[model samples]
Target chain A: MPTVYITAPRDVAPEIARTLVEERLAACVNRLACDSVYRWDGEVLTDEEAVLLAKTTDERYAALRDRVVDLHPSEVPCIERFDESDILDAFGNWRAESVGEG
Target chain B: MPTVYITAPRDVAPEIARTLVEERLAACVNRLACDSVYRWDGEVLTDEEAVLLAKTTDERYAALRDRVVDLHPSEVPCIERFDESDILDAFGNWRAESVGEG
Candidate 1:
């Protein structure tokens, strides 16, 4: 299974999450409040952010990625996909059903 | 490289994250506040939780998993490993250095 990780500003996290679920791009989206420190424009910056872990499968990844980019607020959002060797069977089934025909 | 995802109670999140980094099991830990819905003992429950994303490498996964299990509060903690096909080179180098010699 593939889990997509996306970091967005705190204020827009919920909306982005809802869109993914409503559009059937993900079975579930887990949101976490985080303090992000990274380099940009040759300077290190720290900011409060929200990380969304979207549960999907290999088949749905492309569509999910496209939808996320469309709904994202940042011009170059941090969108990354992760592959897990072990995923709970029940959760995996649910994800497949949620993103049907993706 | 591997990113380990662990879910802990909000109260213990910071400690677990700090321990992983301080002990060099992970280069960085990103914490997120989350609402988890899962099944336990034949009942479905929802609770406030924290998700920790630990950045490390393949060589350190075993030790990191063992140490996380030792330090975790839950009897069966949610410790899952994720692999990314695309990791930024700079971040990957930093992770490799942080978890030196596994």
Candidate 2:
């Protein structure tokens, strides 16, 4: 299975999380509130935001990104996806079960 | 080679990140300002915090944790580590090179 962790402005996490799950693009979404400091344009500023770690199949990644962007509050939300191997069997099974064998 | 990632509160990220890299416990650190929403104490409250993703070797994980706690601002900073496999050869080599072999 592949894991995609998206970092977005805090307020929009719940909306994005609910949408991904309801749409079956992800099996589960773990949301966390945190701060982010980075260089945007020229200046470095710190702000509070929400983090969403979403578990999904590699096949569904593209669709998930499109959906997330549509629902995200920021213009360029951080959407990073990476390949994960040897995932816990129980977690992988749960993810498959959540999305009905997807 | 084994790879590990740590996520910490936003503000404490820089302190922890700098400490880990300087001490040769980590190869590289990615800092993001994000929001984390979770059950703390008895209620779910929202807060602004820095997010840190530190890349380190498996051997150094224990010491890294101890050092991060010593400098972290929060009483209980979130410290979670898991095995990461199929890492890019370049990245793994960079990590090893950073800490000078293991």
Candidate 3:
């Protein structure tokens, strides 16, 4: 299994996280509430957002990406993936146990 | 090995990343150059910084942490770890190969 960090608007994050979790598309989705400031179209934009750091298996990524894109508010959502080796053991086990038999 | 995100001052990120990689404490470190705004000492502080999202193994974490703490400039550096399964296969493979016999 792997962990991925997914960032989206707070309003839409929960919906996307729930859909993925219910489908077992993700082992678990840890939601972090934060204020984000970034640039788009040469304009500095700031907003309240929830970053969904989802944990899932490698096999689940494509489906996860597709579902997130469909459900996300942004036309181009930030669905970045990172390697999972850095996770602590307890957290890793929790994430693994949350998903399919891993 | 696992991927860990180590956020530090730009002046220090590369030093920490390099030391970890050269010592084989981490497989590879991806340097993300960005501006960071965070609260500390009851004050809002912002700075141009670099975040080192280092990749290493579960077994290597303790040693890596010790080394990082010894080397980091901050009194309490951000040595956060996350699950790495979200990483693309190619990146995962690269990270694995960069470390010990993975």
Q: What is the lDDT of residue B14 in candidate 2?
A: 75
Docking class for model 2 is: incorrect
Best by DockQ: 1
Per-residue accuracy of model 2 over B18-79 as CA lDDT, tens digit each: 66666677665556666778788899988776656656677777877788788877787777
| Ranked by DockQ, top first | 1, 3, 2
Better of 1 and 3 by DockQ: 1
TM-score winner between candidates 1 and 3:
1
Task: Write the number of the candidate with greater lDDT, choosing between 2 and 3.
Answer: 3
RMSD of each: 6.3, 8.1, 10.5
- Tell me the TM-score of model 2: 0.56
TM-score of chain B of 2: 0.83
Select the stronger candidate by TM-score from 2 and 3. Answer: 2
Q: Would you give me the overall lDDT of model 1?
A: 0.79
Model 1: per-residue Cα lDDT over B10-93, one tens digit each: 998878887777677777677878899999999999999988888778988899899999999899999998778655344466
